[model samples]
Target chain A: MTAKITVEPSQKRQQAKQLREQQLLILAQQILQQDGFAGLTMDRLTALSSVSKGTIYNHFCSKEDLFTALSVDSLQRQLQLFQRALQIPGHSREQVLALHLAYHRFSMTEPTLFLCLLTATTPAVVEKSSPARLALRQQLELQLAAICQQLITAAIAEGSLQLAAGQSVDALAFVQWAQAFGANALLKPTQQLGLFSQLQPQPTMLLGVNLLLDGLNWKPLSSDWDYHASWQRIMTILATEAPGADGQLN
Target chain B: MTAKITVEPSQKRQQAKQLREQQLLILAQQILQQDGFAGLTMDRLTALSSVSKGTIYNHFCSKEDLFTALSVDSLQRQLQLFQRALQIPGHSREQVLALHLAYHRFSMTEPTLFLCLLTATTPAVVEKSSPARLALRQQLELQLAAICQQLITAAIAEGSLQLAAGQSVDALAFVQWAQAFGANALLKPTQQLGLFSQLQPQPTMLLGVNLLLDGLNWKPLSSDWDYHASWQRIMTILATEAPGADGQLN
Candidate 1:
């Protein structure tokens, strides 16, 4: 009974610490959204939050550390979305497509935070961040990559996907990631610039991912299946399953 | 006689201005390479260059304008490489592959300058850059897209490529651009982080572009042809055709 009493208070304290850290991340994200990266100084964050300067410092050693923390948060959120995306009932191809949709939706909804992924990787941010935080970020990245690798491996196991002579699941997973990143990065700019003015009004991300999946010779090719319908269905399920997922970040 | 004399002096002045601008850009690139984006400033640029401050201002209204000018220069160089890539004796598929190889080579050789493409597009830089420079950047972007479109169209014309019901040359060209951009951006970072350590020693960029091209159903698919051989041949040809393409930027 005495041990339980001691453990309960320690657990409570741990939970409290986590709650405070999460609150700080929300405040930091709000500041970043309002005033670009340049404006997100420790001083400004200290002034805006109810927390004390020393406590905030304890949470993040430097501004770059804070940026890394935000990136870690952003990636955690992406992982959740990917997990939610995989819950949809379908082949590995559809699950992969669902992952792309989740990524695209996340980028669209949290554009500012989405950029943290790029900013955190930059030398300027990485050099200043604490080793512990950097390790956490790398671990998260590997976790995300693992999710992709799992899908690819599952597809191969089920015989729905076949690796060419020199292809490996790791390389193919990396390719999908690059394609998704490339497509999302260009999506808004392409629209604003009217670069594809003559193209149809469909989702370019869907088209790009479909083409990549088709190239991999994944089963239920776009020609064989109505991926357009699958795209809509997956989106609907995600919306219902994780309503206001982006809002949770705030 | 008066007309010839007046024209001669004006032409000479223009030539001198162009020479000074090129020299300033070289100096700016050096500063960027040495000190990174933060170390670059008008004062620093003026201190390093032989040109007067007034002349520098005449060429670039702001530092962002200078970055845009650099991006314009980078794109122009890429266009030259693309044109040279097309000069190789091959089918449209091989030519498209050559374009990817040229892009990969450029990214590897002139990584700092290659980054100018992303830096110039940020809102911070775009808002500060001169309208004329921004317009030129847009024009260069279109010209690059046009090159990709022409290859896709030629492939279709030769019946070596086919588009789905909703696929258009414009969309496919944009996908290729996104794939190249995405793959290049991640390449060095992926290598440094050892993200795909288990993968073979092969160039992942080649694998990525091949997968994307295969997805498009371009002729001489990876299965049907030894694209690895073609990739090597293309690199050799580009190395010879442009002995120091990146050095030209410097």
Candidate 2:
């Protein structure tokens, strides 16, 4: 007798639902980029995507729920860029810096999408989102955090980075994430405000990350090495991942 | 002979306008913290503050303009905190760290205002705010940046911070601001997400600053000295500036 592995009916149904959700999310992202959060009504989404309102509701409980899904999607895309950054041949510090560059490029490439992610985090959005959807977003954030944690662990093991007394890998990862987010999010606007006219996003970010790593007493500190050259290399690696990326950077 | 400093008609008008704006902003902040952004409206402001609609309009061209004004007020408050942080008796590095603590304390004490500042940066808000209001907001941001720049300059001049080749005082100042903003803004939500439950904002921020300072090779690196002791000392100094502050930190 011949035996074959089979998909359960429930699993197949779940897969179909996920596929439909993905289709709606792509259209939602387009709507988000074009019109922003206030414009992302279910009526507009249905009219634009041709996904029936009922079907959209089947995927997302409310507009807030849909926004949460978009946030998850945005982060998934960011996590992918970070994964690509990791593929660049380098030690863990370089890898971490690669992740920083990826974040900056991602922010620059689709600022609207980044804005959507920011909007999705607002108390207004969070208060209305379904518990399950919020849980899923949390899970996505954890996955991204795990990628960063791994880099910190690798750096420690390879002696490329060190933890100060009483410090943990988890705390170090949080610092990196915050530093990158702050630089990418705040730098653009500060410059636009004509406040930090001299502060360039990519360079300022690289400098901040280097100082942070140096503070960690990470091996071959920026003082001992040329991170500017590493930044150039990371840019080249990122360009291979996304064509025309060089044009996106200032 | 004593010369009189007389106020011109335009100057008196401007002074009166400024006082009116401050009164409205205080009421607006109450609404923002209690009812959030959606509930803050001209109708509500008129009802609660008993300020006529025309007078409110005379001060702020629109609700978005009012929010921008609120953002300017919030930054002014933050700048004041930094000024107090600077007055703390200590070395330049400690003074810098004191500013970081002030940011943390400010964020923790009034998260809603910080959220207002974040929302103020959104494109939708920026697009609608009056140009003059935007310019004022920009001016406030520059004032805050100047306070931070002073600390960086002090650190460098005192030999507490050494700039690597190709780094400028402006760039280093920008880096510190970004790093501090990143740590404080990003920490609260991550903990709420339960991703970094073990991470404490004050300590994590101190670590990140220490690393950056270390990267700058700021003297008394965490490895060389007990910065945790310095942290405690800074907290004590800050407590005198604002009583009951010691009870706020975890």
- Misplaced by over 4 Å in model 2 are A1-20, A35-43, A51-62, A244-250, B1-17, B36-42, B52-58, B244-250
Provide the fnat value for model 2, as a fraction from 0 to 1.
0.63
- lDDT for model 1, on a 0 to 1 scale? 0.83
Interface C-alpha RMSD, model 2: 1.9
Score every model by TM-score. Answer: 0.88, 0.87
Per-residue lDDT of model 1, residues A108-146, tens digit only: 888877877766755555667899988887788899999
Model 1 off-target regions past 4 Å?
Answer: A1-21, A35-46, A51-65, A198-202, A246-250, B1-15, B36-43, B51-58, B198-202, B246-250
lDDT of 1 by residue, B90-166 (tens): 88888988999899888878887888776675545665788888888888889999999898888898999988777
In candidate 2, what are the lDDT values of residues B1-250, reduced to their tens digit? 2233455666888988888778788888888788876677799999988678998998888887887887887787787788778888877777778888888888888787787777687765776789998998888878888887887777778777776677888888787777877777777667888889987777888888887877887776667777788888888776676774232334
Per-residue lDDT, model 2, residue A219, is 73
What is the lDDT, from 0 to 100, of the residue B25 in candidate 2?
Answer: 88
Enumerate residue pairs that collide in model 2. A215-B211, A215-B215
